[model samples]
Target: MAQLLVTGGAGYIGSHLVLDLLLAGHDVVVVDDLSTGHHLALTRVAELAGRGCRFVHADIADVATVASALDGVDAVFHLAAFKLVTESMVAPERYFRNNVAGTAALLEAMVRAGVTRLVYSSSAAVYGPQPDAPISEDAQLNPESPYGVSKAQGETMLSWMCARRGWAATSLRYFNPVGTHHSGRIGQPQRDAAALAPRVLNALQHADQPLTVYGTDWPTPDGTCLRDYIHIADLNRAHLLALQVLLPGQHGIFNVGSGRPHSVREVLASCRRVTGREVPTTDGPRRDGDMARSTADASRFHAATGFIATGTLDDMLASAWTWAAHNPAGYAT
Candidate 1:
């Protein structure tokens, strides 16, 4: 019953959220610059859901355009940002201007439009390197990379806005988001993608390109990086839950993950089990800004939003393989 606006509605997570909203009988509007997002994503989500949503081609940094998109919007899911850690480290100015300052502009626009609720897409990268297996939400936030720092700053900005305006805001600090929609209609590499999820899918999309297992010397069960991989569908559902549960004059931070750590080798083995193919693999040194292990402590999110992630590791791998096999070219079909 609410009219929602998503800032990066043409990207992976954003597009899925748009579909979820529309299918729930809510009005949805999207604004995306098409810089790294594909407009075809919105088109396909509309087709699959059998419901149409409006999309405006614009950047979030542009206040006027953002204000226009906020017309009649009751809340927003702000997911627009450049997400590559290496890229962010190299060009931090872009990250600051786009992720941090762009969010500032969006908040100003929302205030002007009297839109007072938001679900901010944050990252667990903001937690930086942790020695422990599963880090709690209350743990110190010492983000090492510029990307993480930018997201942390965005959270601060959102807090200020909520304090001053009585806006309902929930900053979902996402762990690793993997896999795709169960439908396979919308997933993977609509554009150039980095990180483990896309890299794995891209390797499969291209013929026999070896999946690189980064950092094989960590002190873990397998010596590979341990991550909290949450299925994108579960993560998307939590957003809906957060949006519906949050009311005005409230603000909080919550972690989104499976709450269990899965090693890179396990993920690769799962990929093989799902696809029944021997995916090529290689070992490499750890990339910059990566931790040995990081998982979410989901107690807070469960108590607050009543969102429980039920998808298993096999389910994540299977859904990812399904989408990759069908749409190797991602919406080019």
Candidate 2:
């Protein structure tokens, strides 16, 4: 089994990927600052791996700390970054320093340690607002938000580094990543309460509260923002497949998504139906950089690795509701 290092492995998507990597019988190591993540997620990873995993609590920008963690690692999965668009707008420097500078530091460390393969956790926001229904990998990148720019910059740097240093890299540009692991032992913890599903589920479990639907005048069937939501399990499996590609082939870029667009109203309605709660609704103005619709074309990854998302929208809502009901206060317990 290969040894893999996951940067931000305690966070939502990273934690799930860590669990999947361990289950696949690979030696795993994680580095997380716990800024927006829970230490309990790392603890749960340890519980599941049972001595097959190692975790270090440190920011990815710390070259010395990250260098030590990268020792003897074959490949790296860089997932550490500030993800919120609004927060990135308010604190662009923090996002740049953490996402861009931190990635640079990690790349330097990887080169120094002779680690030549990497799988980066990129975002669909890099494409910004596209006129097409489903965006392909070849779509023109014009990121609208600072978060998107930071991720786009990270991808550019990885591409340049891979070409210059002969390193194998894959930037998996992910669409909306949702759902929990099927086991339900570890899912998105309480720290990610601001996310869409978590917020809806939290409101549903707590009381019959009014759910705020941001921007109800979009150009869609339901007049709400449409997104391609992929399951966490499927996203993690795609990561493994990407790593395998790096083993014997050249670097590439791939999109991980279900190629289905569901509106915000539809997601909220799904949550309401699953929880059997009276989810009152309210309309609000659209947030900055909000797109009317954003979906991905998964033909590249599908042809390259034969990957497909198996979870449905109902499955995503049910798992999210299950996690929220069990942990009302997120990961505090």
Candidate 3:
């Protein structure tokens, strides 16, 4: 069994990945600062998997601590970072310090520990507002927000590491990730999430809080922004596939998405249909750095690794609704 390290194991996506790795017979260690992650998520993940993973409460920017956590780790899954676009725009320096500088420190620690295999969790935000319907990997990265810029810079660092350092790495540029695990025991436990799916679920659970439909005048089918929403399960599977197929001295960047564009209104309709509840929404002006449409061309990853996203919009909403209905107050409930 391989010993693996996940940088943000207490967060939503990282928890799922840690469980997946544990079930696959790998020894996993999670290093998290808990700045925005929940310890309860990892607790529940251990309960569900019938085994426990080693948890080290630390930050990736701490090269000394991260170097210690990399002990015997065969590979690393880098997922810890501040993800809110609005927050990053307000404080660009924070994103640069945490996402960019922190990543540099982690790479240094990995090299010190003699571990080179890495799978970076990138974002489609790196593409900003592309004119193409399905953006390919070849598209020029013109990130609008500081958060996006930080991710693009991370990929650039990985490219250099692979070219000169002989590191085997893959950067999976994810679109909007929605849905919860099928068991509903672990999901998006954060309450103030900025993602549309979590915000919709939160609105459905509260009578006084109505979901804000941002940018109702966008140039899309329903005058709302269109995005490629992939199921969390599908997104995690892509990571496992990449981890399994990573070759020595090889580097690749692939897009992990559903390749189907679902607009904001479409998502609301699906939530209403799946939950059998009226989704209350109020139209609002567009948020800064918000894109009109962002879809993915996932054919490159599919051809390279035979990985395809198989979840529909309704399927994603149904799973997320199950989690929200079960845990209205999140893990605290």
Q: Per-candidate TM vs. native?
A: 0.95, 0.94, 0.96
Alpha carbon lDDT of residue 155, candidate 3?
A: 94
Q: Which consecutive 10 residues in model 1 have the weakest lDDT in total?
A: 190-199
Q: Best-fitting candidate, measured by TM-score?
A: 3
lDDT digits (tens) for residues 1-333 of candidate 1: 989999999988888889989988999999999877888888889998998799889989888888988989988999999888888878999999999988999998887788899999999989998766588888989999889999999999888777877888999999988878888888767344566766766666666677788789998888998889898889989998888667676778999998988888888788778877766778888887777888999888998777889888889888877877788777777
Q: What is the C-alpha RMSD of each candidate to the true structure, in Å?
A: 1.6, 1.8, 1.3
**Candidate 1 Cα errors over 4 Å, as ranges:** 190-193, 205-208
List, residue by residue over 1-333, the lDDT tens digit for candidate 3: 899999989988999999888888899999999988889999989998999899999989999999998999999999999898889989999999999999999999999999999999999989987878799999988899999999999999998998899899999999989888888988886475689888898888887889999899998879999899999989989999999667777789999999999999999899889889989889999987677888999999999889989998999999988888899888888
What are the lDDT figures for the candidates, one per model? 0.85, 0.84, 0.91
User: Which candidate should be chosen as best, given lDDT against the real structure?
Assistant: 3
Residue pairs in steric clash, candidate 1?
none
- Overall local distance difference test of candidate 2: 0.84
Worst 10-residue lDDT window, candidate 2:
185-194
Candidate 2 lDDT tens digits, 142-186: 898889999999989987877788788999999888888655556
Poorly placed runs, candidate 3 (over 4 Å): none
Candidate 1 is scored at a TM of 0.95
